[model samples]
Target: MSVIGVVASATGGVEQLREGLVRPLLDREHQVAITVTPTAAAWIAPAERWELERITGLPVRSQPRRPGEARPHPPIDLFVAAPASANTVAKLALGIGDNQALSVLSEGLGSTPMVVFPKVNAAHARHPAWAGHLDTLREAGVVLVEWELLEPRTEAKRELPWDRVLAAVDGLADQFFQGRLRDRGAGVADGGDG
Candidate 1:
């Protein structure tokens, strides 16, 4: 079984969690696990996990982990942090492994291909702190699927293209499961030819 790990922080969209991510992963019947930040638990309701359990028919594990410890797994095929919040994005980019999500990333990053779906505000995305982090993550072999494109005209997050996001996930799965991502000479777009 190809193990896939999904990480999310407190400040992003739940639709990213429900529809954009879990639905696509489960539709393929891949073994999936999720780790959420404490801030995210505070932001979402209990019923949300129940709904995920029903929709994905997979256990939604959200217990916070001790700082610096990665989740135990036999072998992970891919690790993706969708709707990655600015706070978490900066943390992961800097190699700070203080939580399960970050620790999982730190440990599992090179063992298999990983991706980060950044979903910060346009202002935050351009902030030097975050931009530098994005660069660092890219150099560290993390595939960045997308980020906020421009400043928000209103104080609300807009809907992202779920189909494209799923396509990216599917692309990553193909690369890792097919052993092409570790080839070191292939371009990122090699997997985008869908």
Candidate 2:
């Protein structure tokens, strides 16, 4: 099964991450490894954190490992950053890895396929640099789920479109694997051992 790295920031829908995204991915037979921003780590309730660990069978990392320590998670095939806060999105665009979550994402920026859902309000979108940040990420091959697609939320029901995000991930993973297979086939056709 493919291992998916889930990077989350402190956003409105973060509290539902375990139920909305992780569990669903697990049910789909994907191994999930999660890393969260420092603030998000603090914001998540203890019981929820424990449940995340229990369900994923992996540690929920928020800080960098000490020097010379073995990496805890397996190599990730893809990344999903749901409920990505405006602050985190901007920092990612700038290649700033001030925290563990950003560090993992920064290293995977170009090489790995990623799906990002910007959980921002109109005020945040109105920032002068917001568009530029999104453009930069897009140019780097990040698939963005535009905030407009997740509209019409009632004040009491602030939920995210986790299913849509998962669909994007599935689509991208298919494309990535198909491209690799085609490349391998081409090499084999040319009599080169693949």
Best by TM-score: 2
Residue runs of model 1 more than 4 Å from their true location after superposition? 54-58, 64-74, 152-157, 180-194
For model 2, residues 109-144, the per-residue Cα lDDT tens digits are 999999999988777787899999999999999999
What is the clash count for each candidate, in the order shown? Answer: 0, 0
Ten contiguous residues with the weakest lDDT in model 1: 180-189
Against the true structure, what is each candidate's TM-score?
A: 0.78, 0.92
Model 2, residue 185: displacement in angstroms?
3.7
Reference-based lDDT, residue 2, model 2: 86
lDDT of 1 by residue, 1-194 (tens): 57678888886475558877777788788767777776776666788877876775555555654689774433567887887878888888777878766777777755667888777667887676776888888888888877446665655666765666667778878877676545543554476433
